[model samples]
Target: MSLFKKFPFKDKPSTAAITCIHILDEKKTILYVSHDADDGCWQFLCGKEHNIEDSRVVSLQQIYEIDKSIKKIANLEYGKCAYRKYKNSKWNVQ
Candidate 1:
């Protein structure tokens, strides 16, 4: 059996999502996940204050690879977001 299950995000693996350099640098795990209603774009954030220039656009697959826990909210609806207190914490939907 496959070790990882595929998520049904609206975008493809190659599709881009907004993220922080901290996540890409492995400095922090994603603490906030947002699915945009206007464009269906996703955002994986570290839940910290970062400069606008610190934002980066990375593929959805890349973000998934970074934090598999996000898969729990893969079915999150548009305009919705999920957050957690820590890496292993339960996601709180908003």
Candidate 2:
């Protein structure tokens, strides 16, 4: 099988990931993104479930579009909307 055939987001048995969600109304959404203590750029939603309800699966499954590989796309879109709003100081420019 081709290397690309592997699921991008599948965590290996040794690697632990926590997944979360980011809900956006206008822009600058509530990103359930995480960061390591040292480097902060590689942020991602926590990807593991501790329990049924006490988990972020609800949010993850609700994302509109995009695949897990570029999950951050949604977050970035929200951030862009937020920036536009903040820059213009309004959700609608009128």
RMSD of each: 2.2, 10.8
lDDT of each: 0.88, 0.31
Candidate 1 lDDT, 1-94, residue by residue in tens = 4323365455678888999998888679899999999999999999999899999998898888888788899889999999999999999999
Best-performing candidate as measured by lDDT: 1
Worst 10 residues of 2 by lDDT: 78-87
Candidates in order, TM-scores: namely 0.88, 0.23
Error of 1 at 59 (Å): 0.4
In candidate 2, what are the lDDT values of residues 20-61, reduced to their tens digit? 332222223333344233432223332233343433332233
Error of 1 at 14 (Å): 1.0
Which segments of candidate 1 are over 4 A away from where they belong?
A: 1-10
Error of 1 at 76 (Å): 0.7
Q: Which TM-score value belongs to model 1?
A: 0.88
Question: Model 1: how large is the Cα RMSD against the reference?
Answer: 2.2
